[model samples]
Target: MPITARQLLQIFPNAGPVAGVFVPALNEAMARFKIEGRLRVASFLAQVGHESGQLRTVVENLNYSAEGLVKTWPNRFSRVSAAAVARKPEQIANIVYASRMGNGPAVTGDGWKYRGRGLIQVTGWVNYQACGSALGLDLLTKPELLEQPGYAALSAAWYWSKHGLNELSDAGHFLDIGSIINTGKTGTAPHGAAERKALYDRALQVLE
Candidate 1:
């Protein structure tokens, strides 16, 4: 069954103006990804809820404190280096995202340009290019388009489909789905794992 805007609002409550974009995308993605069951919808909603903060924003926030940098991106910043760039959103984005995930050096500006956006925080240049191509959007040149509500939801659905999350959802593997969305690098203790799971539980009640 296709989800209604009323149902989405029941769960999210604050989806606000994005409700128009979100509801249609949810139904379309669910069908395209073959997410037929209520469990599947619940699982997808849970992860997207956590990733997009209930559809509040599509862009990832790069405003980090020194401590946040150390905790969030230890591989990119040390205590001294993090303190130097603390609270600098753009600079921090350029530095932490530099030279990885198919991005060039800081001067290339691909880091900040291809920074996380969309409902599921799609990062990396290669991913943007691929997702854009799949969705018929020129995301490489206009990365900000992913921040728009329609593309934000569609891009997330595309990512979810690409990762075969529908099968995981069918199997009721909520944590596994979360791990995949978290970049396939965390365990039960992954950041926001608990919150994601909590959202899943809540979504089950609302969706079911």
Candidate 2:
């Protein structure tokens, strides 16, 4: 059966003020991308719900005015070893100042550039531009709009279309969505692919 707007709201009851904004957009995106079937809908919603905290954390720290990706400071290897890190007072102050000033995530070779945003957690400037182009929106110019529900929906649909979601069997690689959203890695992970697949299967069964 096809997923409906009511189902989404039921799945995420406490969506708050953004419920009005997200529901219609989600319906539109699902339809636009021809994402039919209850399983796919449930999986997509589950991933987005987990990522955005049911739409409350859409713009990170409620900083819709935030221009671009703002990630934590890098460690000695210049890698984002941890998602949330304890920062020194000066570092915390600098991050705040830079974010307000629209400095965005520093374009280093480091992997920190890909934080999270949009419905699918669109990351990196290249991805932002690609998704924006796919949806006929200039994300590079107005990157902050990814935080907006409407734009976020469009970007996610674009990603789903581009990533060939319709081609893969939902049950075969259910963790693909989670990997895509969380780590920006697609398909399966090298070390824990089997474990991830098991978890995905369990979640899908419960959702269904």
Candidate 3:
């Protein structure tokens, strides 16, 4: 079932005009990915809502404080190291994300170039390549295109569909869905697990 702007707002009241703007794109993406059933739709919307910050921030914010850097990636950032790179979004991106997720070495700048974007944060070169291929977009050349509402919504729905979230949703194993997407410890909460669950509950109620 296609969600009305009113229903979306009910789930994400802080979205303001973004709810209406995303309705078409969201519906299109969901339909394309077969994100049907109340459970599936609610799970998709809830997770997307949290990740995108109520449809407001589609791009990943890499700005980190020294303490934040240490907390977010303890293995990568000692106090001294964190302080050195603190508040440097590009440098932080290059350092923490370096040599992983299909990114080149820190000096290569691929990490900063491919920092997370889109509603679901289609992160890294490998993911961008796959998602771009699926969506027929030239994301390698224009990575920022994921910030656009259409691609943002579509990419998120595509991720949800591809990752088997629909089955998790059907089972109402919402936290597992988050952990899987975050690719974090299974059965344990993912980052922002509480917020994700809260959003899921709100979406379930609103979608009903």
Candidate maximizing TM-score: 3
Clashing pairs in 1: none
Candidate 2 residue pairs in clash (backbone atoms < 3 Å)? none
Residue-level lDDT of model 2, residues 60-120, one tens digit each, is 4422211222333232212242223233322333343333223354333212323356777
- Per residue, candidate 3 scores C-alpha lDDT tens digits across 18-135 of 8999999899999999999899999998889889899999989999999999998999999999999899999999998899989899999989889999889988889999999999
| Per-model CA lDDT versus the true structure | 0.84, 0.58, 0.91
TM-scores of all candidate predictions against the true structure: 0.92, 0.64, 0.96
Q: What is the C-alpha RMSD of each candidate to the true structure, in Å?
A: 1.8, 7.4, 1.2
After superposition, candidate 2 runs with Cα above 4 Å error? 1-5, 61-115, 169-171, 186-208
Error of 1 at 114 (Å): 0.4
Model 1 residue runs over 4 Å out of place are 185-188
Candidate 1 per-residue lDDT over residues 103-139, each given as its tens digit:
9999888888999998899899999989989999899
lDDT, candidate 1, equals: 0.84
User: How displaced is residue 133 in candidate 3, in Å?
Assistant: 0.9
lDDT top scorer: 3
